[model samples]
Target: MTQQPTNESRLERGKRALAEIDGEAGHNVVAALADIAPDFATYLFEFPFGDIYCRPGLDLRSREISTIAALTAMGNASPQLKVHIEAGLNVGLTREEITEIIMQMAVYAGFPAALNGLFAAKEVFARRG
Candidate 1:
């Protein structure tokens, strides 16, 4: 985990990162968790956004690319994949780049996963358009 300013709490840093990266979609995910698992929402922000994502090693675009690929490979996280697909675009990934990333997954993640990812990308792209 990268060091955070002593003044900024993990939740604060996470919220900032989430807003910068995921925008409304990220906030919606956190808000949706409020009634059932508010703590999970906190964890989501603090851990993934605050700790891991806030690291300096990779830029936001690269991080989004990795996230999209991993989610696509899982083949069971279409909803999350959709969110990251949008995030990928938000961070400057062109549709062509996104398609290529998913297509590359077919070799390691199988045709079904790649197809599912492509479809999810299609849905996100359509929504954006």
Candidate 2:
């Protein structure tokens, strides 16, 4: 049988996830998440960062921006996409650049999706301010 992960392995995964997200994780993230479901943080690191995000080619910022575009194209995902848009910003995407990307989506993803994306961006901007 395959070996199960130890608690240490889980924490390592968690740390890796945070690193992938911010490129440099702060103590606050681990301290906060560790207070809640420690496993959740680990899974974020193990699956999202270590497994999926660790894949070759795309940098984290590109991944964040691309995810924003895809979620906007999908539509009916304003709330979730809004979160991702904020994540894009956290990853260093400029407002103008994100706006241009959203606008460009209109051609293929349709006006409704683009509109929702714009609204989401507005929410992110407002929240940031």
Candidate 3:
């Protein structure tokens, strides 16, 4: 039988996940959140990174792809979408692959959403370059 892992404090777990995911980017996100709602910032780190993202089933690269797709579909999460595009690259996705995924979204998410996602991705790529 498998032993259950001991629980850690939310912020502690979040810190670990943030480091593993992409330290600089995660810190930047949290820092931006700090001035407005520190509690929500904590939740952002704790839930997404600490709990869901750290789950064992999917690898980080796969998770980033799924996140990119979901954010693209949402159509209104441009800032968050751009962050995930960069995160996708951090997890080893190539610019070509990321662009392909965004283009694929046009079929289901419509041209508007796909176009916005592509633009967000373009900005991320441009910034990186």
The candidate that wins on lDDT is 1
For candidate 2, give the lDDT.
0.70
Ranking by TM-score: 1, 3, 2
Per-residue lDDT tens digits of candidate 1, residues 1-129? 235687988899898888888889899999999999999999998999988899888999999989999998998999999989988888889999999999999999999999999999999999999
The list of candidate 1 runs beyond 4 A from truth reads: 1-6
- Residue-wise C-alpha lDDT for candidate 2, range 21-109, written one tens digit per residue: 55332334445788777777666666765555556678767887788889889988886576666667767788898898888889989
Q: Identify the candidate with maximal TM-score.
A: 1
lDDT of 1: 0.91
Candidate 2 stretches greater than 4 Å from native? 1-11, 18-45
lDDT minimum window of 10 residues, candidate 3: 1-10
Task: Using lDDT as the measure, name the better of candidate 1 and candidate 3.
Answer: 1
lDDT order, best first, reads: 1, 3, 2
RMSD of each: 2.1, 6.7, 3.3
Q: What is the lDDT of residue 53 in candidate 2?
A: 53
Clash statistics: count for each candidate? 0, 0, 0
TM-score of candidate 3 versus the correct structure, residues matched by position: 0.89
Task: Give the CA lDDT, 0 to 100, for residue 92 in model 2.
Answer: 79
lDDT (tens digit, per residue) of candidate 3 on 1-129: 011246876677767777666657778988988889899988987898777877787888899889899999889999889888888888788999999989988999999999999999999999999
